[model samples]
Target: MTMRTFASMAKPGVTSALPLKEIPGSYGLPLVDSLVDRFDYFVTEGAENFFKTRIQKYKSTVLRVNMPPGPPIVSDPRVIMLLDAKTFPTLFDLTKVDKRDVLTGAYMPSTDFTGGYRTAVYQDPSEKTHGKLKAFCFEVLKMSRPRIFPEFTKAFDELSVEVEKEFENEGKASFSDKVDDLIFNFLCRALIGADPVAPGPASLGNSGPTHLKTWLAPQLAPIASSGILPKVLDELTIHTITLPFALVSRDYKKLYDFVDTRGSALLDVAQNEMGLQRDEACHDLLFHIGFNAFGGMFILFPSIVKYIAKAGQDLQREIAKEVRGAVEANGGLNMKALESMPLLRSVVYEVLRMDPPVPLQYARARKDFMVESYDAQYEIKEGELLGGYQPLATKDSHVFANAEEFVPGRFLGEEGEKLLEYVLWSNGRETDESTVDNKQCAGKDIVPMVARLLVAHLFLRYDSFAVDESSSSAIFTQLTKAS
Candidate 1:
């Protein structure tokens, strides 16, 4: 019989604390909690495994999945495998069923299956149906300052002003606490939008955000100091804590009921004030994006920030060199920024190499087909796609030098064509990659442009100093300092 150990699922008005089986693959057992601990490792390693599994089985079937956080959901590799197999016209078939995953909480596959299923499909992002797969960069980035990035930066600036004023009297720990407060508000305001089209759950009217924030603050407190918690926990606590918010806000039944009553006008009010365009984007994409982006940026940004702060010897020079050269002195950064800044470009390349945000991309088998059929005359018909990460084409040692180091200038010498072509999305032919492997994050092509510009401004305008001898030591000390 199926076992039950720690089956935890969250849905509106319902909390799934059902005990799940302790087995390795069972849903919601504590082991699954490892998703929080080794997120990158799991995605990268798991993708490779899935790829190898399908290629071995010579099987084909659409496998639906539901991993949390809306993290890199569309990056599933089955789609890539299908496109790859299509070239052979006989290797296999792949289909990506972009289903509504988040609201449901559990992935009920198109069919309930038995052993060795293609299970990498996941991500419950709320978009205009599969739009998250397409729209994250363009819809979010072009918005004016103080919406996503600008808005958060503004909140941080206000918080920075307050922190600076208080620094005259506050202690070091106090300064840290204030900074955390700023981060909290910055996160909320950035994700929720400035206006109230910003529908959240029953805001507790009087004490929800505060109470939740207050309740959540301690979770990170130890992370800042005692250092007992691992790196992943410290970084991901907010996203995990915000799950309850999802449980509340997704309650359209209750929300619509309220709209039917007195809150009906809120729709128009929110639409106008929040600048929400039905044709543009949705609150779910905006909010959930915080979840996806926070993980991606924090995974690498803190380290980058520390590098900048501590590299006092050459910080300004490096910034000006990469930015002025890549963004300004050159043409300008639009999508093409994905090339240029070979040094900064390698930064992204190496980070993705070392830590793929989510190794798997979501897709399923549309039909069965064969692999090596020319020799054995056998088949892997319909649904099976290769089960694995495409590190072959992505982080291929031949394509990338050192393939191991975080060398900032690794991509510098390649000509624009070679550098642009080296990226996983642009370099490989079909049957050679996983789904999301072919693309970086949405707007990935342009992300480096924005980041380089932002970092350039910070380095040029602000004289940043190391908070301590080594930024890593600072990270270690922060484990115990924030509280």
Candidate 2:
């Protein structure tokens, strides 16, 4: 659907000239209301339905709602929910939105989680340290560019050997553990300038992802609801309560020391050239890779596998033919090869569109401004927390033709590529470039590049693979004969 066509989908004649209305919905009573909303959010309605029910009830896309972990944990549980493509981008405007402590929306994780320093993700563009740290992150990526392909390929080769050995010995391969190890090794080698397992006092070996996960979980416990336990119990324990950083302190220190010692090269640049303190730079580096980049792929890689596996054999054969042909035609599996493989790129994009690793994005309003939804305008006051559930926004029927179905070629050609601007998984549109000035993920381009590489390598090694998600966790249930 075209932009004009989607604009027509809005309420007829609800133009920019329409008078602003008070944002709909309410926070209700203090504790009682927040508890009820938290229960409904994590237990009854689920994340999507929680917003969906409200949107239907208010008959509007933008409304006031209580985000989870109210009261003692989050000073203010109320936030302005932006649920449509039209209004969601407002959160990305750094000039108007203060991205200070809204990383997880209202609940700021203790700085103890990152060695007593706020990471780049938590800092707004307006902060001077934010620029330095963000620039350092970009430089890390730039310096690591030459290493990414080689390290990723080596790690993937090792991963493939394990997957094959498991499948040969047993009838299937459990990919999650193997994939996690691959991600940590590749990221550490590429970004940190040393192999994680190489002989050293600080060698993490295969436990790097675990260290990162342990540090990440408690900090996010206040907002995390994976349905790991029964509803009532899960709500009380996981969602409403704040998890202490003390639990992960030892593990976090291991990560801190490893980065500080092993990644001294990058830290030296941060201190000597970039004018950042070494200790602060170490914490920021660990958070950037360990939490943001490593943590991201830790969720995303499996998702890509799950989607491709569900697409069945035909899509696999098509991807295999396309990827192999592109590599052969371009003379190697490099950037040129990736560019030639439109279908491969689209498949990754489709997975991202369907299941973004980071589902929510939040920013506090900097000043009073008018926010427009698909149909109406609402006046937002300064410092009001503005958030969006991107999974719902990307699937808005107004902007996308099939919004729900996984069409592998949805982002194939020039026309198809236009749809990418609405893909906001990286804290910004895929069409937008990431720079030190914005909150866009530093590894935005690197992420999909590595993902594309992983997918390409898999098809090249095997004709196809299948997954069995029927079990408690998704696993590689089978694979066709290796090519």
Candidate 3:
């Protein structure tokens, strides 16, 4: 697999909707605010290049290169930098093209994030990029279906009870809203197993961790994405040099405190429920269901809902295929019941492929590496870094054939295995080009399991809509209806 170039994506109408990569709100936010612009460009243009393994231009942005692309390693630390003397030129040097770091402008959160919600662009060694992505897709994605409506919405719970404990009036006020209640309901059940005020599942009375997890996600978002803003960072005059850092230190300590407190309870409940007998990454029904369903899950729900809604009739039909079959035979649904639906599984996979919650990954370059096949030097020198995007890779015509068409069987049939390895979340086998193993589902055969089951149950048995990208721009509504 040679390095994929975005130019290859120019297959017909490949880049026609490429501009969507520019703004977060789809049609809004027209300017490049910061380093994120570079990533948008890569995805827009390089999306087609994902077909092969090489990275290519996705879109050309107004956010031009102020400094030439530098070693990929230096930019890796671009996450939390003090834009002082060192940061000024260092950022420039990091962007210099001379360095192995394919500096464009893509990043994934590194501070402390769970799951695969952060996005970034990475410099790559062509084929290896594909391999690394295969490993990720398998490992991260769920094996089953989503927790669909009816059952998901049925079991009632006094939602946001724990959070209500934290902010008091604030929590009550916020939770009163429909969407807020929905997010809280999904999270509460997923976390404690019982929705205290609502229904069953039994609870361990663990509110400490539950509440902390609630506030942690949004609180950390601002710092991670835009870090202490320019004014805040600049406020620290000479005398306060160590002061802000001290406050930050305190905040850091608080995070540990919160994690330890909440994580401990979660660990116990999660371990007990899963009947864990060995050391694992805490990925059981408790953690998996809780984290994605409740905990830190709200981040991407809005966008996903829109996408699903936009898919409209096609989405409904696909949902029916997965859900309908199960209802006709297996009665209702559970993890196993959802497994019967393949179309549901495939469609979910394609949805993720096109609009990954994180788009790209942020990993600093370990060292300057070369794309052995392309024979091009991709400097990953120390202090430099790179990010890899699955969107650009998945949309590549070179790999996906039609590329943009949402053909459900796009990943099915003969070449299924080949595309499977292309997913950014999974642990598939490694193989060289030519006689490469086409491990269908790219090892991410699992990620969609829960969602599949949940959706299948809804599509087949209950009444609910799909989560396509075309729903509505109001990302928040997706969260609102989960209840």
Candidate 4:
């Protein structure tokens, strides 16, 4: 396995012909440096500033630095930061990068959290299980296609009612909270033919998302801060030390049982058709739905709305007009209707570029390889950890003009469409196809489709809406409907 050149990996003209330079920055002194970097990462500078200040210090997009969840949890916190679009795609190349145990970056959750199985996410393409599990994931997505649009509408219809009722009574509605509920419901209904709200084998009631959050929080705590605790306390506790999985074992068990009962058909296909054990299938199914599908939506839908809300009514009116026109012309809001609405599609793509649901992507160098930024190349040794902070990469000013601003039509037209290669929200480039051999998201197409549906539905039901962004979540303060 060998490294592809910067020119080969990135869009033409995105890479430079400049000579290689030594990677700058340092790990300082072992754990001491990691602890300080971790403190600055979580406590002082925050995620964006942590990288920004360093880029300014080193004056390079590619630098060596300490990533968080350092010493005890992760043996080494050292990573070569690939901050620009030119170098970020190297993380996608399996020929040179080993993806095992780097999904969450630096640390991996206990297999106990995943029913004593590694789950598909932790496996690299080189691993034997990767092919089977990834293929199964693709199969599940294929099975859910027919239900995806209808179930999305069903769930979002309920969400609109909830938002309307809340606004009528309380004068404002929390969009994040409402959307989270619908996303979970929609995933359960479409993927497994079970509803968390409906009574049955899958009826965990509305507590389903809560159960999943409880299970996921521990796994993510080492690399993430809850913001619920003081910065120092959060850093010392969840950020420094790995939380015991035993705490969430019961929550996980309940989720596992729910899937074992409700996802029996998916399990059957996994076992009989795909050669996985029933228990392994159940755990992977739960992870795919709970973590990947529901979790992706939990972060993504709110982001889409937040960006649109902040973009103001001018963008909203344009999108609403396009959505309504497409639906009317096609005689319904089906795939054909979605295909005709470029503004709606661009809005979703822009949101993904701006605030990718998963902000960091990780891989380890499989062998010695040279990676490049605009002006310099850095030789990465075998087994070196690599991290790509995608938000910064996607927002590269060279690739996107006015990258910081929310331009809803940024991805519209022939020229704009070419920029899709830069959208790395789904593990792989937006233009890249998801295959079992690559780490790209299996439901890559499905996610955008559902997201577009959510936006299209919102505009169809209401003319324009106003959001309060002072808080972390979007609060719908005003929703105007066409008379």
> What is the lDDT of every predicted structure here?
0.36, 0.86, 0.35, 0.87
Q: Worst lDDT window (10 residues) for model 2?
A: 2-11
Candidate 1: residue 269 lDDT (0-100): 39
Provide the TM-score for each candidate, comma-separated: 0.47, 0.94, 0.48, 0.95
lDDT of 2 at 241: 73
| 60-122 per-residue lDDT for model 1 (tens digits) | 221212233322222212122321221222211222222233111222222111011211122
Best by lDDT: 4
> Per-residue CA lDDT of candidate 4, range 1-483, in tens?
223354333234354466657899999998898889988988899999999999999999999999978886756889998999999999999988999989878778888788789988899988998889989988888888899888989998899899889999998988887787798889988988777787776468888888989998988888777868998888768876777889998888878888788888888899999898888888888999888888888999888888998899898889889999999999999999999999899989999999999999999999886786788777788999999999999999989999888888899999999999999999999999999988999999989998999999999899998888787888888889764
How many clashes (backbone N, Cα, C below 3 Å) per candidate? 53, 0, 95, 0
Flag regions of model 4 displaced more than 4 Å.
1-17
lDDT of 3 by residue, 237-266 (tens): 211121222323333343333333434454
Clashing pairs in model 2? Answer: none
lDDT of 2 by residue, 223-336 (tens): 775446787786767666777888888888888888989898899999999999999999999888887888889888998998999998999999999988998998889888
The TM-score leader among the candidates is: 4
lDDT comparing candidate 4 with the true structure: 0.87
**Which 10-residue window in model 4 sums to the lowest lDDT?**
1-10
Evaluate residue 34 in candidate 1 and report its C-alpha lDDT on the 0 to 100 scale: 31
